[model samples]
Structures are given as C-alpha cells and as structure tokens.
Target: MLKKLYGKLEISINALESWMKERKNLAGLLVGIVILGGLIGCAIWLNQPVEGEVPTSASQMAYEKASVTAVLEDGAVPDYEDAEGRRVGTQELEIRILTGTHKGEIMSLTNYMSALFNVDVEKGDQIIVRIMTDEDGSYYASLFNYNRGIVLGVFVLIFFILLAVLGGKKGLGALLGLLFTLASIWFVLIPCLIRGIPAIAATVGIVAVTAAGALVLLNGFSLKTLCSVLGCVIGVVAAGGIAALVGNITPMNGFNMPEAENLLLYGADKGMKISGLLVCGVLISALGAVMDVALGIASSIWELHEQNPSLPGRALFRSGMHIGRDAMGTMANTLILAFAGSSLNMLILVQTYDIPFIQLINTDYICIEIIQSVAGALGILLTVPIVAFISARLMARGKRVS
Candidate 1:
C-alpha cells in the first residue's frame, strides 16, 4: 500500500510538472488574474452596504455638489480674522445644488470667514454642500468643502498609467502582489485578530504566506524565491522576538501609538494582547525592508552562481557576504529614516517643549519609536547574512555536489 501511494505521488508530481511546462506563459498570467479576481471579490464582500433601522426622529443628512450662484452680502462679523491681521466676516451666497436629490435646487448658505476651516466662495465657484433636515421637514445647508476628488482621481490614473508603461508585465505582477498583500491584511489578519487569535502566531503565519506568495508571483518558483522567503521569515521572526523582549523589559507601553489608547480599551475588553499587537506592528514595519534585503542578496547570489556554475561553495558564500554588507548600509538607513519621518512631528514637539535629553530618551513614545526602528533595522541586518549564506548554498548546490 505504501509503495502504491508513493508511485501515485510521483506520477502526480511528474504530470503536474509536464502540464506546467506546456503552459509556461499562461501560468503567470492566470496566477495574476486569480489573485486580482480574489482582491475584487474581497473588496465587494467587505463593502456591501448593510441596511440599518431608520430613525424616525433623527435628522436627515446628505452631501451634494453646488455652484455659487451669487454673492448676496459681505461684511465684517468681528468673530474671525484673516492671515493678514484683518478682521474677517460672514459672506452670504446663493447656490444651486448640482447633485443629490436637490439637483438644480437653489439655496443660500453663509460662510464665516475664519483663518482656518472655512471656505470663502464667490460666484461660479464649485463647492460641496451638506444638507440636514429636521424631523419637522425643515432643512439647512452648509458649505462642506471644495470638490477635490477629480484631482485625486487624475493623480491616481497617472500613477497606474506610468506603472504600466514603465514596468510592463512586471508592473502588473507588482500591482497584483500589492493588492494581495493589502487584502490579506484587511481580510485575513485583522479578522483573525478580532476573533481572538494570538497576535504573534497570526502575524508570523500571515507574513510568511505573504512573503512566499509575493516572492513566487514576482520571481517565479525558483531558488531566488525560496531564498528570499526563508530570509524574510527569519528576519520578521527575529524582529518580533526582539520587540517582545524589549517591550517587556522597558517601561514603554503599546499605547505610544496614535489611537492606541482606543484600541487598547477595546482590545482589553475583548481580551486582546496589546503587547503582542505592538510586537506585530514592529514585525510588519520591518518586513518590507527585510524582504528588500533578502531579494537583493538572493538575486546577487543567484546571478553570481549563474555566471560561475562551478564556483566553490566557500567562494559563493564570500561573494554573497560582500554584496550583503554593501546592501546593509543603505537598507539600515532606509528603515531608520522611514520611522523618523513618520514621527517627525512628535520629535519636533519634544524639542519645542524643551524636553531634557534624558527625559526625552526615557519617554514612552520616543522609546517605542526607537525600539521599532532599531529592531527593524537589526532584522534587515541579520537577514542579509542569513539570506547570503542560504542563497549561496542553494544556488551552488549542484556545483558543490559535482
């Protein structure tokens, strides 16, 4: 029975290999299509609007676009000021709704000219209006903001067009991989966390799957993919481990992040582990940088081995180490700078408040940022040599055996 099973398994592997070889070009295309289709399905499923019970006495609200029909009045209200040290006032304007149920309906709105959060409008200006109705059917409208979606949409269109034109097939693959990464996080990772799965375990599994899937899709199922995936796994795990250890020993709380207090309140109520989540964040933050280094080292080793198929294992390892050292310099800087950029405002606050050096260093927020940034950089640094060694061994496998 065992022999028969082995025979069947061997036959299945051979058949699948033969089938893939016959449709080599179609395989990558099909993979991309399947991933993209799954992403669209996830988006549709997540965004399906659910009908809720309507409140009978609640105010009705709707957003609409409008065009300023005319400036009816302008005067100083003494409640607001302009940037030029002049007292600003209210401006009343007649406007016509261009969208929503109020299309073509004319109305009037008052704009209080404030230095901030107010839009000064004139005739022919396009604007957004927020309509609110009382239970007695009385309604009021206010200027919401300017219509900015068109500008944003144009920029998005330009980005995709440039990606396609510049990157060709690889660009499509990259886009698909990006979509997959996002879907996995939104659909899989978050849901699992909400369901009370341990954060570290869930993060490790999700990241490993993401790394492998993305690498295979980008590089195909080759030694390069394997090397990169393995390296990423080690790096991410190491980063998480370091974060967990440091967080436990230090006085820092996971509440150092924005909105973390709310999350902690909710998460604690749900029995979620804030410390684990913090470590998970550190792991994920470092993941992209580590994956970059892994890919860089693996590709270099693969290229070197390809050029000298009979190169000695020691020689290949040495070459990989040399390449990794060069990559580590910039990759470490990338991780550190990325963290610093995100916390630039907070850093400025410390300086602005005249925080002492020792106090600033011991502060929970700054310490958390330091741990996250340093741990991630350390992960990248470690992944380099690990990837270099593994890739060299695997790429030089046949040569070494011969």
Candidate 2:
C-alpha cells in the first residue's frame, strides 16, 4: 500500500488544466468553510435567549481583576462568609450585557461570591468569566463570561478568508488538515482516554495519526512527508518520557493544573492515577512545537530538493540542518516570550515583592508554566537534528527510483 501511494507521488502532473482545476476546487472549499462557519454562528445567535429570558451576565472579563461596586445605600450587610467564619466583604458590581439577543440590561454582580476566586474586585478590572442563566429571566454568574463562542466564530471567519486569499488551493488543503486535526483530537483521542486507554499511548497514537494525515494531505506521501512524520513522532516520545520522569520524582499538589488537580483530589478517593493525567497534559502541550519542528525541517529539505533535484544527501541534510537551526532559535524564543507576555502582570507582582528565588521558582503556577515552555523547547531542539540526520541517511543510501 505504501509503495503504490509513494509511486503516485513521484508521477508528476502532466496537464496544466488539472492544476487550474485544483485551484478552483480550493477556492470553493474556502468559500464553503466561511459559509458554514457563518451559518453556525447565525444558528447559535438565533437560538440564544429571547427577551425577558434569564439575563446572562459576566464580571471583570478579558482581564484578571475582579469586578467591584459599592451600593448607593449605606451599610449593605455582606452576605458571604469565608472559611474562618469571617464575613467576606461584598462589592456591588454594575453590569451591562455587551452582546447577544439581550444587548442592553443592567445587573449587579460581586466578587468573593465563590470559593474559586481570590482577587479583590474594583471599579475597573477585566477578567475572563463564565456566566450561568436558567430558562427563566433570573441569572447569576458562575464565573465571568460564558460565551467565548462568539469571539471564536469571528476569528474562524477571518482565518478562512485570509487562507483563501493567501494560498488559494493549498490553503484549502491546510484548512482540511486543521479541521481533521481538531476532529481527531476531540473524537479519537479524548474518547480513547476516557475509555481507559493509557494516556501516554493515546497521545502518541493521536500525534502519529494527526501528523500523517496533515503531512500527507498537505505534501503528499513522499520523502518530505516521511521525514516530517518520523521527526514529529520522535519529538512526542521524548516529551512524554521527560514529563513522566519529572512527574514521578517531584510530584506537587498538582493543582498547578486546573481540572487535573481537582480530579486528582477526587480520584485519590476513587483510586485513579491522576499523575497519569498530568503527564498527559505535558505531552499534549508539547505536541504543537513537535509538529512545527518536524514540518519545518522536512519542508526545507523538500524545497531544497525542488530547487536542485540532483543535490546529494549530504548537502540536503546540511540544508535541512541549517534551516532548522535558525527555526529553533526563533521558535523557542517565541514560546518563552508568549508565556512572558501572558503573565506580565503576575511577573510584576514577583518583581514588586522582590520575591526570593527559592519562593519564586517554587511557586506552583510559575513551575507549571516553566514546564510547559521548557519541555516543548527541548522537544523542538531535539526534533530538528533528528529529522535532518535521518532524512540524510535514508536519502543517501537510496537511488531515486526511475
């Protein structure tokens, strides 16, 4: 099966019109994606609550600070109590609906209403929120904003349009690759894990499936696709091994992650291995960078081959390695800077307190973020060289089949 598929890849397209047809097909695909996404958005909007339905409200959204307000009436007794039986102060929050069918409604919200929050609310601070509303007009926020879907839809629209304009038919292939990735992760990986499959094995399997589907669908089943798949698989395994070793030696309270920690606290009673779940998180987080490193090196080798098909394996390996070196430097920096940018404010608090190195690095949140950045970086660095080295060995030993 692999031989037959590989043979087709080597057979060049002989007709110019076929290439144009591919372009038209891709253009149609982009249009279809945008239309489908827009339809979904419209469906969601239409199905949203009608007037006098329970008003959906959120607190300091889009930022980390809580929302607070003082009632106009003096001496409003606070209704919330903390763990120590001390009356936790309440701040009156004036809320307005920003979007949806119920666009204009004023409501009052508060901070410290739930045990999940710690930040003090103020007049102006933004935080992500999840809101809950019943079928009735009554509503109370469980968190901040409940509807991220609206924003997600807008971004999807922009992405499909941009892809259509940018690469035409190839863009369509990329889009298909993306949709397939999302589908497999949600449908195949998550279901397999929930059904008692080993998390590590499931992760490896999904990565393998995703990498092959994406690379083949984009580059076709050829040398380029082979190198990328092989590279990505190695990187994923390295990441899984590193995560497992680190987790075994120094297990934290593990609330360093969200649901995993909660599940751990609960799972201990049920005798489930929550540590396995944590390892899964680390593996999943590293998957993106692994694919990036693999594809980057493989694609560079392919482009080099196209430019000079007669180039020897040694030179092709060197080309891939050089390109990978440059890519790794920027990509690793990108991952770190992205983390720093997201946590700039928390970092400010660390700086303000002159936090001792021991306390700062040991902090649970900081530790987890570091794990995310560093593990991914290590995987990426290792992948670039591995892909280049193996591709060279394979190509050098082979005579191009006529």
Candidate 3:
C-alpha cells in the first residue's frame, strides 16, 4: 500500500508540472499578441493625413488608370539625336479610362517617348494618366507611366509565401517583426522628422524601439533578447556618432548631399532639420547589420552556457569573441561591398572620364560613400565585444542563481 501510494503521488506531481509549463507558454503568447496589436493600432492612428495640407495646384490634379484602346499615331522626330543617340518619337493613342471619376470615358492623348523617359506601350496595355482641371471646368489628360502595381503586388505575395513556407513558425515571427520595423519607420520616424523633431534624437529613439520590439517578437522575452537589444542600440548609435564627427570635421553635411536643395525648398516651411539627416541615415542603415551581429553572438553565448552550466563567465566570453571574430570579416565586407555596388554607376563614370585619384577622393559624393561604409563597419566591430561581454555576464549569473 505504501509503494502504490508513492507511485500515484509521483504521477500527480509530473502532471502538475506539465500543466504549469503549458500555462506559462499560453501567458507568453497572450502578452505577445497584446503588444503586437497595440503597435499596429498606433501605427494606423499616426498614418492619417492631416487636413488642409495639400497644395491648391496638387488638389486640382488626379491620377487614373487607363487602357490603350488604339495606337492612332507613332513617328520618330527627325534630328533628335540629343536623346543619347536613342530614338525620340511621339505616339497618339486612344485610351479608355478604367478608374476614378472618368471611368469608362474614351479620350485621345499624346504620349512622348525618349531615351530617358520612355513608356512605349501597345494596344491593351494598362497605364497611368495624369488629369488636370482648368478654372473653366475643362480637363486635359496625359500619359504618366505604365501601370505596374499588379506586378509589384504579385512579387511581394510570392516573397511572403516563400518566407512562410521555408521558415515555418519562426519565419512567421520574422515576417511580423519586419512589418513592425517598417511601420515604425514610416509611421513614427518619418512623421517625427517632418514635424520638426530633432533628427538625430528621433532617429536614435526609433532605432532603439524597433530593435527592442523586433528582438522581443523574434526571440520572445529572454535574457538573450535583452542583451541583443542593448548591444544593437549601442552599436548603431556609435556608428551615427562617428559619422557625425567625420561630417563636422570635413565640413560636409546634408547640404552637400544631392537631394539637399530639393528638400530645403520643399521642407523649409515645415521646420525640417536637414543638418542631422546624414547621421540619421547612417544610424538607420547600420541597424540591420548591427542587430544581426549582436543577436548571433548573444544567442551563441547563451547556448554555450546552457550546454555546460559549469562554464565560467570568462570562458563564455572567450567563446563569444571567437564566434564574433569569424562573423566580423564577412559582415564588414558586406557593408563595404553594398556601398560600392550602389555607387557602381558613379564609379564607372569616374573611370570612363579618367578622373585623377586626388580629385576623385575629394569629391563630396565619394567621401560620403566612404564614410557611410566605414562607419557602419566600425559599428559592427564594436557590437561584437558589447554583445559578448553582456551575454557572458548574464548567462553566468543566471546559472549561479538557479
């Protein structure tokens, strides 16, 4: 009787333990859902357009979709070699409006084609048309561009399908995290900058928020996620600081950027802080890579400690550093090569013109590219040690306490 009672007690205890574990997991899932839902609601609220913000001229114009019904005329213009030796011509087409206020209206429009801005279309091709209203209530329509929205939509769908199929539950978590990051940028960061918030501070705040949220969503609430979040924020801020210091020393700033003039003209009245835009850009660009390095090191260190709870903090630290060093080479090269690839056209131009090395290096465009690449790489370098040290200390302490 005593032995049978003991066995029954053991089974009951095991069942209780299993139940507690399931309850804990369910609680975590509930918390995650709440946080994610709140974030989405906030994003939607912040994305609403402000009333009376549209200019008068822009309010009088509309874009509508149309399909080419017939090609009424197509002829090349003579002596138009100015288009880089490419054919310059014009096309007259009859189009039927497919959407907006003029849906089902048939009209004849002139479509211009050139080497730089060509939209050669055939019959049955869908395109975008810009319509303008005059004071007398008359309207004019012109060919704007080809309608590629369906193609883009389909491509994005394919990407989501592949991500879900390959990654399973983890992939779904990653997809949610990605959407959160984009929402924070578009709904929070850009709006704050446009509303005259200090660019550097706003960008850094967004970087931290997005990093923390993404890591939490990806790994759930854990010491590893916390360490990675801290490491990523520090590394990205360090990169931005380095870029800002270089910009000040070289007397280069957003004003030297190609789009600065246009931004000034459009955003001056809106109180935009253009000076810090360059540093803001660097912080955002470096964030993904920094987060990757930090999480990788932290996760590795945590796994090491889990496998051998007897390992000392120093041993875990050393193991993390070794892993980080292996990652550094490829990550640094990745940043530099990305920058170079984006500027391939400019590099080709310099080579074609046989630009002197001194002149080439001194150009603002070239200097900006170099600073971006180097600063981002330096951030990754710093993240390695930060993540290693933090992960080691935390994992070791957890083991000791347990």
State each model's CA lDDT, in order.
0.79, 0.65, 0.87
After superposition, which runs of candidate 1 have C-alpha atoms over 4 Å from their true positions? 1-71, 74-89, 93-105, 118-137, 264-273, 399-402
- As for model 2, its CA RMSD to the true structure in angstroms is 11.0
Note the residue pairs that clash in candidate 1: none
Which predicted model would earn the best lDDT? 3
TM-score of 3: 0.89
Ranking by TM-score: 3, 1, 2
lDDT by residue for model 2 over 1-402, one digit each (tens)? 998877766564434546866776576557546744654454455345446643323332222222323332222234355434333444556555444433444456654443433434444444344455567956554335333465789999899989867967767767777777777677666655544567678778777767766765676556767788898889877876776676566564245566776666444443344446655666677777777788888777766666666778889888888889898888788778878998999999999989999999888778777776776777788899899987776655544410
The numbered model that scores best in TM-score is 3
Pairs that clash in candidate 2: 54-137, 60-127, 61-127, 63-126, 63-127, 69-92, 129-144, 129-145, 130-143, 130-144
lDDT of model 1, residue 83: 54
Error of 1 at 310 (Å): 1.2
Clashes of each: 0, 10, 0
- Model 1 scores a TM of 0.77
Candidate 1 lDDT over 297-343, as tens digits, reads: 88888888878799877788898899899888898899889888998
Which 10-residue window of candidate 1 scores lowest in summed lDDT? Answer: 50-59
